[model samples]
Target: MIRTLLMIGLIGFLSLVFLHAPVRAEGEFGGLALGNGQLIFEAQCVGCHVHGGNIIRRGKTLKLKALQRNHRDSVEAIANLVRNGKMPMSAYKDSLTEQEILDVSAYVLNQAQQGWN
Candidate 1:
């Protein structure tokens, strides 16, 4: 009975560890662990940039063409913009960490490339 209890405890512990583990994905988008980006975007940016479309400024949309035209085609450019707000847009430097800005920038670029579909 002791052996069975020990095995069950071990199994439960292993299950918890695996279930709580961060899931990392390998892919073209720098193999980033993706959940944080989407979650952050949803929580912070979705209101202004829903589906990559800019409600505040149509010309400043997050679409690939707009991003390219505005010289924000790269992740670094996007991250900088996010960190330091440009006029109408509010800065997120205080609210989000650098890593989080990078993640969301990557996500935005990826979504733009995919046409936000």
Candidate 2:
């Protein structure tokens, strides 16, 4: 029925909105301010991850190809790697709170998709 079709469309629209909402969460700065993610990236992740390149692991670049191949194409995958760490990458789970990890993950994904411009 038309009712069922309308409900399906509504559900699809809602799902898109929820999935794409920015994860700019409140943090040490005190409020849900934006760009803190960029700041965190600069202070913490920029050294090796600058310009989407991994200084240590050349194969694990943040560019779309490497990310996709390593099964890290999603924000959750990146966040988990950052929190848990692997090999040369030390764990930030203790250093960064969950919100900070989420923010940085969003930043990295956004930057990577833009070719790290």
Candidate 3:
């Protein structure tokens, strides 16, 4: 019947819209680094740096304000710290490869720069 066909068409349209809706990720780093940056953060940095706060509160916090003070908006500095690991900040060289370090660093830097919802 005409009603059945119209209902089916409406359902199909709504399904497509729902399924294809833009996926907004939780942090500022989403859609960057081909979308793998956040995954790297979850794997490497989540335990000691939950939401940019250090677990022991020893190192400088990683939010925008702290990063402005410590890193001074230098992505390279942040990257170097991630690679070399300042004293008391466990060196990730053994646990993560160079690329992994870069990815995770990019993720953190992005979040530190822009913040997240």
lDDT of each: 0.87, 0.79, 0.68
TM-score of each: 0.77, 0.70, 0.63
**By lDDT, highest first, what's the ranking?**
1, 2, 3
- What does the lDDT read for residue 16 in candidate 3? 70
Q: State model 1's lDDT.
A: 0.87
Compose the digit string of candidate 2's lDDT tens values, residues 28-88.
Answer: 4344323656767877988998888989999989898898899998778988998999999
Tens digits of per-residue lDDT for model 1, 37-105:
776898899999999999999999999999999999998899999999998999999999988898888
Segments of candidate 1 deviating more than 4 angstroms: 1-23
Residue 96 CA error for candidate 3 (Å)?
2.1
Best by lDDT: 1
Error of 1 at 40 (Å): 0.4
Give the better candidate number (1 or 2) by TM-score: 1
